[model samples]
Target chain A: MSISCDWPQAIIGVLLSQNVDLVAHVPDAGHAALIRLAEGHDQIDVVTLTSEEEGVGLLCGAWAGGRNGVLLMQSSGVGNCINALALPEICRIPFLTIVSMRGEWEEFVPWQIPMGLATPKVFEAMHVEVFRATEEQHVAETVDAAGDFAFTTRRSAAVLLSQQMLGAKQFKEG
Target chain B: MLERRTLVDRLLRHRPDNALTVSSLGSPTWDIASTGDNPLHFGFIGAMGQAAPFALGLAMAEPNKRVVLFAGDGELLMSLGILATIANKAPANLAIVSLDNESYGETGGQSTATAGPTDLEAVAKACGFSQTCTATSEEALDAVCDQVWTAKGPAFINLKIVCGPSPLVFPHSFDGATAMNRFRDAINKLGQTQGSYGRSNESEI
Candidate 1:
C-alpha cells in the first residue's frame, strides 16, 4: 500500500542540504519513506544503530570526517537522546535530526503520547532547537532550513515531521 | 587509584584554551573546577551515554582545537560501540578520559559493568585504541598524560577515580529553562564566531 506523496523529495532535499554522506537510524514505522529513500541512495552510507543515542555518536563521527549526516528516529527516541544531544550542543557540532513525531494528530498507540508530549519540552529544556513538519509541502523546505540552522548555529536542530505528513499508508504496509 | 581532585587539577593545567570538554553526569567534578571562560561544553542533561561522540563532533568542527571527553565508566559502558567508530576514523586531537568509579554513581551508586572486576583499559585496547592507560594513582596519571596526549590516534585514559557527589545540582529538576537558554546562547555565540557557515532564520520541523 504505497501512497503518492512528495515525502521522498523532501528527504532528498534534506540529504542534499546536509551533504549527508552517512545516514544513521533506528527503524520506526513512520520513517519508512525516508529510510527507503536512504537505502536507494548510493552516495550515502546508511548504518542501522542499536539505539537512538548511538545514532548521535554516528552522526558526530560522520560530521568529524567532513561528511554531513542525519539521525532518523521516532519522538520517543528523542527521550532516549536528551543526554546524547548534549554532544552536539556543547561541541558546537551542527547536528541535523529528523524525528517522526508520535501521540499527536493521528496517534493510535498510548505509549507514544508520553514521549510525544515530552519531546518538544525536553528539547527545549536541553536547549536544542526544534521545528515541526506538519504538511507534505513543507517537508523539503523545513528540512533544508533545519540543516542550515544546525550548520550555521553549530548546534543540534530537529525537524519533528508529523505522522500525518508521512501518512498512515506509509506505516500500514510496514 | 588517583583521587578525583588530582585528576581534575592535572586536566585543568593541561587543557589548552579553545579546547572543548564534555563531561558525563557522574562524580569527578572536572567540569566545575576546570571549565572557565574558555569554550567548555559539559553534559548535565539526561543521564545516558553521550560524551565521546559529542567530543567527536567538536573535534570535527574545530579540527585545530583539542577535544576532550570526561566520561564515567557507567556512561561509557552505555555506548561502548562509539570506541569502534572512533578507532576506525582516528581523530588525533580527540582524547577520551573515563573516570572509573566502579558504579553508576549518579543513580544512587547502582552496580554496572564496572562494579565487577572489569577492566576498561582492556576493553579500549580490544576496540583498537592505539594508546590505552589505566591510572590508579596520581603518579601513574601524570606519567601517562604525555603518552595519552601525544598519540597520533584516539587515546583512552581509565582513571580509577573515587566516587563522590556529582557536584552539579540536577539542572533539569529546576531552572532547566534558564540553563538551556544560557547554553543556547553560548553555542550560538561560538558558532557565529568560529563556524564557517552562517545560520538560517527560518524555523524548521
Candidate 2:
C-alpha cells in the first residue's frame, strides 16, 4: 500500500514561492498530485499540453513576457522535446522542467526503458543541466535548487524524480 | 490566391496597440520583420512549430493584453495538437493566424500537408476555437484580419497564400536571448506606463 507523501505540497510551495507564474504539463501519473496542487492555486496559470514539446514553447513565451514557468512531464516525454527545446536553449530563456522518471528498478513497462534511460543524457546534449532526486526528502530542495540555478543563470534545467522516489506504477488486473 | 506579405502587412496594420505578436521561424518571421522590428513583435530565430504555444503562454501571462501567433501552415502542422491545448486553456486574448501557402517556402517549395488534404481551419474548429474561419481572397483576408484583431477569440484563421518569388527580409538578429529580453523590456515599459502588470526592474537586478 502506498501512503501519501508531503513532497508534492513542498514542491508546489517552492514553485509558488519562486514566483513561477505558469505551469505547463502533459498528463503523467508521477506528476498528477503536483499538477493538481498547481491547478488549484490561484497565482499560477496551468496550461495542459497535448504533447510534451509544447511546454518548451509555452515556457519560452513566459520567459519572453518576464514570467517564469515549469514543465512537468514523464521521462518518455523528454524525447518528444528534443527539437522544440532548441527554442529556449538557443534563446537563452530560463526554464525548469521537473521530470517524473520511469523505467528503472522494478519497472513494469518495457517500451519506456529506452527513452527513460536516455532522458538525462538527451537533456545534457541539448545543453540543459540535469539533477536527479532518488530520495523523498531531497525532492523539494532539489526542485528549489533547480529553479534557482536555471532562472538565475538563464539556462534550462531538469530535475528527474526517479522511479524509486515516485514508487512503482502499480500493475492491475483488468 | 492570397499573397502572404500583403496579408501579414494588413494584419499588422489592424492589430491593436497592446497586442503582442509572435511569428514562427522562416517566412513568417521575415514577413513580420519586414513590417518593423517592434519590441512587441517577437520573431523566432529558429524554433519551428512553436509560435502558437509561445503566444499561448504570453496570452495567459498578460491577460489584459491581446496576443497573436503568426505562422505558416506547414509550421503549424508540425505541432497540430497545440490547437487543442490552446483550446483547453482558452485564453480569451489569444488568436492564431495561419498563412497557408501550401508549401514549405524555406525548404525550397516542397508541398506540405496543407497542399494535400489537411484543412487547418477545420482542425482548429474541431479543437474548439471560439472563432474559426478561412481566407482565400484579398477581400476575405481583410475580413478575417478584422475578426482576428477585434473579435473575442481564441480565434483561428487559415489565410491561403500563393507561395512565390517573395524576397526574404531577415530579422536583424538570430540571437534568441536578445529577442526574448527585448520583448520583456517592451512589456515592462508598457506595464509601467499603464501602471499595471510589469515586473519591477529592481527585482531583476
Candidate 3:
C-alpha cells in the first residue's frame, strides 16, 4: 500500500531489506507514515520512546542482544541525543537514526531552526557521519548505503531528511 | 534502609546463569564489580540515563535470557521518561533495580528527587510494569528477591539504600569497545548453553 509520503515508504523498504528488526522512535508528524508501516510489518518491532535519547541506548542494547535496530526522530530531537551518542562513538556500536528535518529556510516555526541547522555539526562532533536527502528520489538509496556502512563498519550514521522534501509547515496568525 | 553494596553482592551471589546484567556508571557499576567481574556484565563507561533502556533492548533481543539493570536513583531521574518507555515495551526478560539511596553517591551524596516526593516503584507501577516493589530492609529484599530473577516482568524494585560512601570496585576496563565486544560475543556464542557465557576468542581488553 502507498501513501502520499513516498519517502517514508522508500525508507521503510530500505530498512526492511537491511534486516533491521527493532525501530525505536518518538512520535513526529513527518514520521507518522513510516512509523505506521514499521508497526504493521511482521519483521520489525516498534518501540515507542518518551524521548529520542532512549533510542540510542536501546539500539546499542539491540546490538548486544544480537539484533539490528534503527531510531526515528525529528531534527529537534537531535539535541536530546547528543550526549547519548557517546556510547556508539567510544564502543563502536553500529546504529542508525533517520531524522525528519524541520526549521529550514522557509520554516514557519523559529524554534526548530537552531537544532535543524546545527544537526549535522552536532553529529560530526560525536564522530557520527551525517547523510542528507533533500530529494525524494534519493532518500531510499542514501539511507540504504548509509545503513549498510554503519552496520558493517560498526559505526554510527544519521540520515537527515530535509524539510524541502517534506514540504513546508505553514504557521497561521489568527 | 538496606545497605547498597551488600544488596548488590547478595543479588549477584544468586544471579541466574541465563541472566545478563547492565549497570549504570559510577556507584552501581562499582557495586557490581565488587562482587566479581563476569563476562556477562555490560558496564557502562558513560551513558548516564541509558541503563534501563539498554537492558530493555537486550531483553527483547534475547528473549531466552533475563536482563537486569542496576542503576542509581539520580541516574534514573535523568531519564525518568525511560520508565514509561520500558513499561510500554514490556520486555518479560527485563527487570530494573534502582539503588535508591535518595542521593547521588558519586557527587558527595547530594539529595535527589527520590529523596523528596518521588517514588520510583510507584512510577514503575504507574508506567504499567507487571511487577513493582520497594524494599527498605534486608528482610524485605530477601522476600522479594526472587521476583527480580524469576518473576513475570518487566519488574521494578526500588531498594531504599543508605546514603554513604562505599569502596569502589572498578571494572577491569572501562572502555566501551571492549565491553561491547565481550557482551555481543557472549550473547551470540553463549545462547545454546543456557546463556552462561564462556571464554571468547577475543583477548580481554
Candidate 4:
C-alpha cells in the first residue's frame, strides 16, 4: 500500500513528543514512507538493522545512553522481537514502537496472518502494551500516548498502524 | 548446592534503592518478595537473551546506582551477543548474575545452551569481564557477593542454583497493564531522587 504524505508529519510529531533520538527499523513496504521520514530527519539517528531482534538490542543500548528511542517494523517483525522485548521488560527501559500491521487489514500475503494474530497475544504474553492506529489523525496521538505510557511506566509499549492508513500509491504505465 | 532461597535472601539484603533487577520468567520468586522499595525490573518480556543489555542500559543511565540482571542460562544463551557489547562498553555499575540451572526452567525444564560444560565462567572471561566466577554453594555465593556488588566494569557471576517455578503469578497472561501501575510508581519514585533519565529534546528525523 502507498503510505500517506501526512503520515510523515504525524510521525514527526510523535517523535517530537516522545523525545525519540534513535530509531531502529527493518525495512517494510508499508513503512517506507515512515522510513523516509525518519531518514530525512537530522535529529533522529536512524539505524537500519539486519533483523527485528537487532533493532531491539540497538534500542536497548540507545535507551541506556539516556536517549529515547523506538523500533519500527512490520507485524512479522514483532514475532522476531519476542525474546528481544524481554530485555526492555526485565531492565525497565521503556521505549515506544510503531508496528506496520498486516494479516488483519486486507493483507496480500498469507505469512503475515500468523504474526498479525500473534502480535497482540505475543505482546500480552511478554508484558508489553499494544495499541492499534486506524487513521492518520490517530497516529500522532496514539504514538505520543504510547510513549508517555512507556516513559512514565518504564516499560515497552507499541502502536500498530493498519495498512489502510498507509494509503494506496499511484502508478503510471506507458 | 546453593538453595535458590539463600541467593534471594542475599540479593534482597544487598539490593540498593532504585536498583534494577532483571529476572527470567520463572527462576526465583523469593528474590521478588524481597524486592521491597527498590525498583524491580522483570525481564519476562521478549528476548530471553537480552537481559544483560537492558541492565547495561539502566546501569549506564544511573551510573551511581547498581543494576542487577537476574538471568537464566537459557535466556543468556539466546542473546550472547550482549556480552560482547557489554565488554566493549564496560559499565562499572552493572552486575549480571545468571542463575545457572542448566535448563530453560520456564518452558518445563528443558535443556539449554549451558546444559553441557559450556563453562559460563569461561564465556564471561572471553567476553572481557575481569571478574567472573561460579557459585555452587551458599558460602561461595556469599563470598562472591561483595565482589559482584562492588566490582567495577561489567561483572558476570554464575549462580549454580536449583530451578523452580516463579512465585508471582499474573491473574491473566503477563502484559503491560499487569505491573504497569506498580512499576510506574516505583520508577517515578526513583526519578524523583535520580533526576529525569529521559531525554528532553526529540530526534528530528
Instruction: Name the better of 1 and 2 by lDDT.
Output: 2
Per prediction, fnat is 0.20, 0.60, 0.63, 0.28
Instruction: Give the alpha carbon lDDT tens digit for every residue of B48-146 in model 1.
Output: 666566566546555555667778888788888778766765768778888888877767887777778778888888988888888888767767676
Candidate 3 lDDT tens digits, A1-174: 233447777888888777787899998888888999999988789999999999999988877776778999999999999889998888888879999988885788878889988999999998889998887788899999889878878889999888888777765699
> Where in model 2 is the C-alpha error above 4 Å?
A1-5, B192-196, B199-203
In angstroms, give how far residue A83 of model 3 lies from its true place: 0.5
The number of the candidate with the highest DockQ is 2
lDDT for each residue of candidate 4 in A29-68, tens digit (9 for 90 to 100): 7788778887888876666654577667556654654567
**Two-chain DockQ for each candidate model:** 0.19, 0.57, 0.47, 0.18
Question: By the lDDT metric, which is better: model 2 or model 4?
Answer: 2
Off by over 4 Å in 3: A1-5, A170-174, B192-205
Which 10-residue window of candidate 4 chain B scores lowest in summed lDDT? B169-178
lDDT per residue for candidate 3 within B1-205, as digits (tens), equals: 9988888888887889768999998988889889997888998858799887788888877777878999999889999899998888788878899899898889887899898999989989998999998899988978677877889899998899998888878996888898788878776766553322221111233
lDDT of each: 0.68, 0.85, 0.85, 0.69
Please state the Cα-based DockQ of model 4 relative to the true two-chain complex. Answer: 0.18
Chain B TM, per prediction: 0.77, 0.93, 0.91, 0.81
TM agreement with the true structure for every prediction: 0.64, 0.95, 0.93, 0.61
Worst 10 residues of 1 chain A by lDDT: A165-174
Chain B TM-score, structure 2: 0.93
What DockQ score does model 2 reach against the true complex? 0.57
As for candidate 3, its clashing pairs are none
Ranking by DockQ: 2, 3, 1, 4
Q: Name the weakest run of 10 consecutive residues (lDDT summed) in model 1 chain B.
A: B196-205
